[model samples]
Target: MFSLSSSADAQVEPFKGERIDPDVTSGHLNHLTPDQQAAFNVFKDTLAKAQLYSPERPHPTHDEPTLLRFLRARRFDPQKAYKQFADAEAWRKKHNVDALYATFPVDEFERARRFYPRWTGRRDKNGLPVYVYRIASLSGPLQKELNTIPPERRYQRIVALYETMTRFVLRLCTHLPHRTEPTPISSVTTIIDLDQVSLPTLWQLRSHLQEASALATANYPETLSTIAVVNSPSFFPTVWSWIKPWFDEGTRRKVHVLGKDPGPTLRTLIDPKDLPKPYGGELDWKFEDEPALDDAAKAVISEMPKGPVVFENGEVRRPTPPDPADVSSGES
Candidate 1:
């Protein structure tokens, strides 16, 4: 009968940090004699490999002998090392630079309006056509708060807030249903281009839009609908082409430095008359026909039932009416 043989399995070792040989440390300058150090220094000078001695130096110099030897052993050139370090520092500085914010240019907006196809697409689920806006007004309070911060911090803060707002808008957009075609706002007789507005102005406009959207959602739930359009083939090409290259090199540079692309997902919209003109300018074309609000949009607005000013019983009553004394004092 063949005898069964048993063999013990080799034990596996658990992972530990990388092992560095003691000999490698021994080869470092800490092990060299004064004479060796001097000789190594000469070798380093001939090799042009400098060692960084202190933080104040900002670069490596041909001072430390052991460091020189260590560099030579690694085939490190001090001049090249210094250049590499400088390049790295430069890149870091560029990345750390703050983003610049400004209002959309009026000329650019006009150009976009002229060249880009007017969105004649279907309405979103709420029966409203895609809305477009220029930076109209910025929040004075927010602007004041931003101005108080240091320049380096201010741009970063604004960018962060902008991102937050963009996300919020996207969330709102997703909730709305898709429409076959956008319903034109008949009341909007003119499409004035206010592109020359400053960044602060745009920020203010965005603030107002956000506040209004939120209020409409809360108070007139039935009336307002939110929707986001990303890479909207219908509108993105027009908007992006019009705005991208028109920005000055400084603005583009800031965008690059900040690593922000403001890609297709950045396009946003708000409904009806929420985004009004900052200071009205004449539109190139006028809408001869007035468009009516769709049933879906009306339903949204209606959902947030307003407090009754007149009761069903034909009695005039005010819900949450202001006190006469408070109204007189202008404190209501």
Candidate 2:
């Protein structure tokens, strides 16, 4: 239902789109409108009645930032926010989300991950994880590899990727020294390149895309900071129409179809060092490349307490610190 512009001629012109605001922090609550604050308060008050309590914690365990996220997603409607919040909690339980992440095999995790968007182990200007998905990468050997895997395995891997984003990626962002913000980094920026999209290509990846869209909408609402559809073909308008319905309005508003030339706009949103070189950024990486967690990020994960990323109640959980001294004094 939406196109970048009204005029046909201007539609294909590549340009940076709307600005995506940063995540809300506890310190930022004073800036919220009266009604918005009230809605968040009410959402918190009703948590007990909702019975969305986490197993590891005594009461419902949502943080202030988490509370605001649900309320904002529903436009400050406390009741609506409460419903989705409860629903997501139930979804997590049904999917065994915590245990899945704790136990998913490493090799399968890495292989299945490549089919989804690649997180560049980088963050955008606002300190959000950045993901690059190249449509062209779907063809050839990758397509054959993807086909060999069972649908359920692929689905679980996608879930794990999101789990890592919440449990690992966002957690690492909170420690980046360059970012001088109190707010926790809660969302991500995605650039989906449609360089050689065609009817057959669309048909091939339709199911996976739809499932991923539905997953994001249902359980990860309000976690998208930006989505740039770049290197789009001339017939992108028609393609957009077909793809548009997959996302809800809140997410769609954040999308910008930046035709053939996306370099300029991408650089504006992301520093060149953080972005992949292909898109006029300084990072020496590409979409097909499997991202390596840099040492700093790895250290953050290693020392983390190690607990379920999120409770069944939709509350974020931080891991405890590592224990030292495995050394035994007496023997061998």
| Highest-scoring model, TM-score | 2
**How accurate locally is residue 281 in candidate 2, as Cα lDDT from 0 to 100?**
80
Model 1, residue 118: displacement in angstroms?
22
CA RMSD for every model? 28.6, 8.3
Clashing pairs in 2: 272-282, 305-319, 305-320, 306-319
Per-residue lDDT of 1-332 in model 2, one digit per residue for the tens?
A: 01111223333345445443444343234557777777766777787565553323464355565666677778888889889888887787667665677667766776766677778877788777788888788888988888887888777777877877766666567656435466666667888878877767767877778777778677766667777778878777666566666766666666666776677788878877888887768788887675644455555544322323432232345333222231121110
Give each model's whole-structure lDDT: 0.28, 0.66
Per-prediction TM-score, please? Answer: 0.21, 0.79
Q: How many backbone clashes does candidate 1 have?
A: 34
Candidate 2 local accuracy as lDDT?
A: 0.66
Q: How many residue pairs clash (N, CA or C atoms closer than 3 angstroms) in each of the candidate models, in the order given?
A: 34, 4
The digit string of per-residue lDDT tens for model 1 on 1-332 reads: 00000111110111121221112122234555565556555545544533323423544432243243333333354454344434432432343311111222323322222111122122322333433322221235544554454654433333322222222222222223433112211110112223344444543444333333332222111111222211122332333333434322222221110011112111222232322222121112222211233344344332212212221122223233345474454331
lDDT of 1 at 307: 18
